[model samples]
Target: MFQSTAPQRRSIPHGRRRAALWAAVVPLLVAAPIALTGEAQAATPGTSVSYATTCTPGVVPAIHGTTISEITVDNATPKVGDTVNVTYDVTQPASGNPTSTALPANVILPTGVVSLGGAQTGTVTVSGTRTNPPVPGNAPFPAFQMTGSFVVSNPGAITLSPGNYNINSNYIISLDTPCTIDTPPAGVSNTITASPATVPNNRVITDSPSSGPAGTKVAISGSGFTAGATVTVAGFSGTTATSDVTQATADASGNLTATLTVNAAATTGIIAFEGATYTPATASPPVAYSVTAVVPPGGSSQTLNSSVKGGTLSMTQAGSTVTMTPVDFGTGGSSTGALNAITVKDFRGGSSGWSLTASNTNFTGPGGSSLPAAGLSWTPSCTTTAGSPSTCAAGSAGAVGTAGATLASAPAATLTGGQFAAGANLSLTVPAFTAPGSYSSTLTLTLA
Candidate 1:
């Protein structure tokens, strides 16, 4: 069985608190699509609208014209159930009486249609301060931008058209100013595509030979991890506190493979293997492995001495002692070479495991000028011989300094006694200020 955790909501930026308040209101208006009315009259700088206002509760509302432009959606890629900010530019034409003033505004957004079929509706709330001239004059209101937040209810194309916007006022008394839009500006509405929500922490980890004796080799695999991320494989005994852990890097396909052997000290119990990232935010379902103890022969109450023959364990390389391309850094500060295919044969029958390591000497130039051994780095890789049951793994990439580095390895249980082919992309770095001359270095590979 698999379990999933809830995804956390995205945090909004500071100073955009108005959008947050509208998020709570947009979801409630997701019923049938609301149809808009009226036809295009005369096109304005933005969207033209006729405004009817009342500065006093008992007085008749005044009339004016305004345009709304610069409609924008903050999120380029919105997802269903996500809260996004939609902003608009409004410019009021000179008109309201000497005591009229604009107040906080609220608007219903145009119905949105999902590409996959379905309609979504929402609203916007303007929370910015609404006080500027005309408290008593004939000047046009300054152009300003208003922003509101809305929850994306569906996936697909969402077009925001001109809608009913209400502007309140406080001119010695509370008043309401309702505005009606006649038509939307040509190609002025912003369209945003909302995608389907993604599943959170979805991953699967599995292993072969789930039930085995101590020293049994198991091949473990994981998928749905972040690409190029390191994945940790952990094992815990069901009946004991004993545990083990190993790591492998996920490939471009977000898949990982590793080999682990049941610990020798492990007692008969279930060994659960789980895969997770470095942060370990989430883990895949445990792949249970049963451990069975090896039984000894029983006899009639008598003591007997017995000896078991140990098998041979060793590594042998085919062809030359080492296979590397000759490097010629012709007038160069840096260059690269390749470590040709060099197969290492591990005939160690049921042995714990083996590691192939490499180190290098400093490149010696004419007259003995030298480049640091650390300048030589490599991206190591390895593959099991064809038809081989062995699962060979490449070690992490690193420089081949005097201290050396593991180039490749195979876990104890992963190999049924076979050959491992190893190679690497070699890079050589030389200081720019170094004297121009031919340099040479020796690389040594060892199996342990």
Candidate 2:
């Protein structure tokens, strides 16, 4: 470095300095545009911090000539297990070229509903022409159309809200069968009636019997009697007698008959006939009949005679004497005398055993004269000294006596008459009887 004494430099003014700096920086600033262009070319458009924006109409633009119309789903009534066809039509919008747009893929169905196969989702083409014509040259927008169907397994009315929903939405479509829980027809009733109106008394009618005989043929005639009708007979004591009777279907006349046989030994009582109609109709009233048994030969009559007068005889034997007495036995006593008795003949005369003797017994007057105490005796045989022959002897002579007698040390004997209402119990007691077997005698109780 040469050290030289420079003349005192005059200070440069600020404005002149600034002008000189600008003159030098002018070319650099001028080259900035070229550098920015190069950098811009190296980077992608998206990386830029600044961008431009514009607004477009929210609604789809209208197409000329082609029109857009709102779509509607009509309410439908469907039967169970039946399919219903639903149709929706779209009209293209005017003022803009119609473009092909696919319909939404899914539609919500009501609860308890299922869609039939096929026709689900996608675009369908609808051709249309521009009225005013597109602004020269550009291709006309394509139009779209679509169709679908569904079925209702249950019957009902379903409403759809105006909005998008997932599958199986708010309400469901259903079909109901006739007569089911939901669907029912109007005006139906049931009734039942008997045929012939009245059954004959004492006649063996098929179902109605007054007194059924063992082989009696009865005809039970009634209305509402059909092939499946059941018939039964009930007795007065609630005893039920069943029979597999013949059943006839009603013709145009609405009458039927069933034949039945009455059982033998059935009590004489009321006969009741009952019938039941199934499923389709109600049952009928039970018919009844009064019955009686046929009379047999020699059977006692139910009537009584006013003029008959009854009398009775009682007898007892003591030691060697037999006594008889007369008394009133009433109506029952007279009936007892009517019974027949079998006599046992004695091959060996026995005077000691027992006896009914005519000579020993005596009758008083009128009513007593008819008493049967004669020509009967029970005697024992006596041994002869030679033992060659045996002799039989009557042990007692007769005397009038009371109906009962007793021995000093004999077991008590009881004689009881058959059961009788009122009056007296016909009884006898005998004393000193020497028989181990039963000894009985028949006496005539007179009905004067």
- lDDT for each candidate structure: 0.49, 0.23
> What TM-score quantifies how close candidate 1 is to the native fold?
0.33
Q: How far is candidate 1 from the true structure (C-alpha RMSD, Å)?
A: 23.8
Candidate 1 lDDT by residue in tens digits, 399-424:
76555688887765523457778888
lDDT of 1 at 277: 22
- The number of the candidate with the highest lDDT is 1
Off by over 4 Å in 2: 1-209, 227-239, 242-254, 267-283, 300-448
- How well is each residue in 191-223 modelled by candidate 2, as lDDT tens digits? 111122211121122354544445565566655
